[model samples]
Target: MRRLKSVVTSAVLAFGALAATAGTPAQAATEVRYVALGDSYASGVGAGHYDSASGDCKRSQLGYPALWAGVHDEYQLTDVSCSGATMADVRANQLSALSTDTDAVTLTVGGNDAQFSSVVQACLTKDDAYCKTATDWMSYYATHQMADELAALYRDIKARAPHAEIAVLGYPQALSATGTCPVIDLGSAKRGYMNDFADALAEGTKAAADKESVTFIDVRDAFQGHGACGSDPWINNLSSGTEVFHPTLAGYIAGYYGELDGAWS
Candidate 1:
């Protein structure tokens, strides 16, 4: 009886040791919280109506950020992009939207700061050389100034979301080379200005990202043939006189997916 009891006790001890050895320490899951900040493009202004549950800021789930989040379910997203948002808006106005746990961020801004819409509007209304020259000068100043602002925004995001991966998106071309309308004409000079403006914004974004060691994804080349001029264009035109230029749903999807593939992959 004593021998049998000893054998059972030894077997139980060995089983407990085996169980302990097989057990492993639990690993912390990779937290991927996405915080989107910036202006109309980030807000998805031209995409469609906003979700009332999200906020009154007109943020859309169909926006690139949301689309990115949808595909990458691991991310917890906080999209605070609004139409007409300036650099100051991101620094000062978007604090409420930021969380302590953000792991990634993306933004689109500076066009409004350059008053790009106003430039397009002016181009549509005026034909004089003086107007064109004045607009060109303004575009130059705005481009440089916007670079500074973009740098500032990058700094702010770093400060707020230290662990987050940052991506500053560039604006896509708004008009076709052939022009959207005969009446609301966009000539070669104007087209050059717009494209140049986009290029400047892209450069500015890159400079800012480089300064902070942030990952800057350049979508300009990706969007080249897919602009308003393409047979299957991404940008939208004023169907009548009311809607001048914006992105179509397909355009937004392309932009969103491109960014996602670039960033997540």
Candidate 2:
């Protein structure tokens, strides 16, 4: 990515010099504004290469939004997504970045609203019966309560960026039910619970997207064989204490950005 940045910068400088000397047509004075709003998944918590300017938000330059912005030079990214952000956080802290001039927006929320991370932690540490009960309750909340909250948040986002093309992203499960890893793999039942949680979130997100007439990018299956237990894991594990159970750098590519590339147009 650093090499790519250098190349793009040099090309842009050359292009500008040529345009200045040859009386070429001018490009837009400002790039198309793209705002990213959501929580840790949107902020790239597990991925390294953090932008220090983002502070504790840990916005990775490799996250889908940054990668998309890097490739599309005509677009300017205002990534306000932060780790531990909820719907409330987006509304209160992130929505200010949106407006009629905003050309596009990508959001990944609701998981934090459902407290899915805490649930995953509990499932990993607690007994099976407790895990089953907590997971089931959280799934129900995600499908029912969190869905409503998301729909309302979508309404607000649409109101703020009336002309923006909005895309709401769904979370991917980080573990596989039948797969195994040394000490890091989730038990089959725990994996089932985690998968169920992801499904419930997806179900709600899809329904809300349909309700608000926006695009919902379902990326659950995109990381199918790349879970923490898979042969080729893209999600971080216990070994990676930075942000365990979250997607790694490769995951932001193949699992997230790759899917967005197809649906974005």
Candidate 3:
């Protein structure tokens, strides 16, 4: 009777050990293959820290893509976003990262193609009159040319990452259309033009996204009070070369990624 009792106890213990070993977390998280693509905003140029190996691409670990990927272990990210990437540049340099297995993609572009940054630079280097001409041209380009350009790019991305859900993120409002702050105080005329430029760009990008059946995430409202002229600023100014008009770390975390989190399905 004693020997039998001992044998039963040992068997019970062994079974419990096995069950614990194979317990609750039955399997690891399903791996989601994610690819980050597009220009500086996607690359996190202004967010400060960078992956030096990315070279001029300046892929920031704090960028919206990295932030989103970091929160969920399921996501495996390949960030290929680069600074100064035009639509053509993306097709040439970045699209190769995409494949049928790519589950998620986020892109921010078209501002470079429209020469929006150059307009800002003009206001800083030259005068509001020069900026006004540039802004007018940029607005026209955004309305007339950018939509079709973006549509073509979207189609190309869809073709490459056939299974991936792509979201094209639009830029934030860089300055409030009203008031003056020494930080970025472009006169009200230039500020108004910049605001119009943002509006035109958003319309074009959104139209392209709708036409292509991808999602377009507008960041304007998300960054409403954080523009240069606002109480708090999320965008960097002539403070640096590459980071000009780019988002700060806080902006990417709470603004860009914040809006994206809600849209992510």
By TM-score, the best candidate is 2
Ranking by TM-score: 2, 3, 1
lDDT of 1 at 109: 77
Model 2, 36-87: lDDT tens per residue? 9998889888867787889988987767787676656676778999988989
Q: What is the clash count of model 3?
A: 0
TM-score of 3: 0.85
As a whole number from 0 to 100, the lDDT of residue 232 in candidate 1 is 59
Query: Worst 10-residue stretch by lDDT in candidate 1?
Result: 18-27
Worst 10-residue lDDT window for candidate 2 reads 17-26
Which segments of candidate 2 are over 4 A away from where they belong? Answer: 1-27, 182-185
Which ranges in model 3 have alpha carbons more than 4 Å from their true place?
1-29, 178-184
lDDT of 2 at 125: 85
Superposed Cα deviation of residue 72, candidate 1 (Å): 0.9
TM-scores for every candidate against the unseen true structure: 0.79, 0.87, 0.85
Superposed by TM-score, candidate 1 places the C-alpha of residue 262 at a distance from the truth, in angstroms, of 1.6
Q: Which candidate should be chosen as best, given lDDT against the real structure?
A: 2
Error of 3 at 31 (Å): 1.1
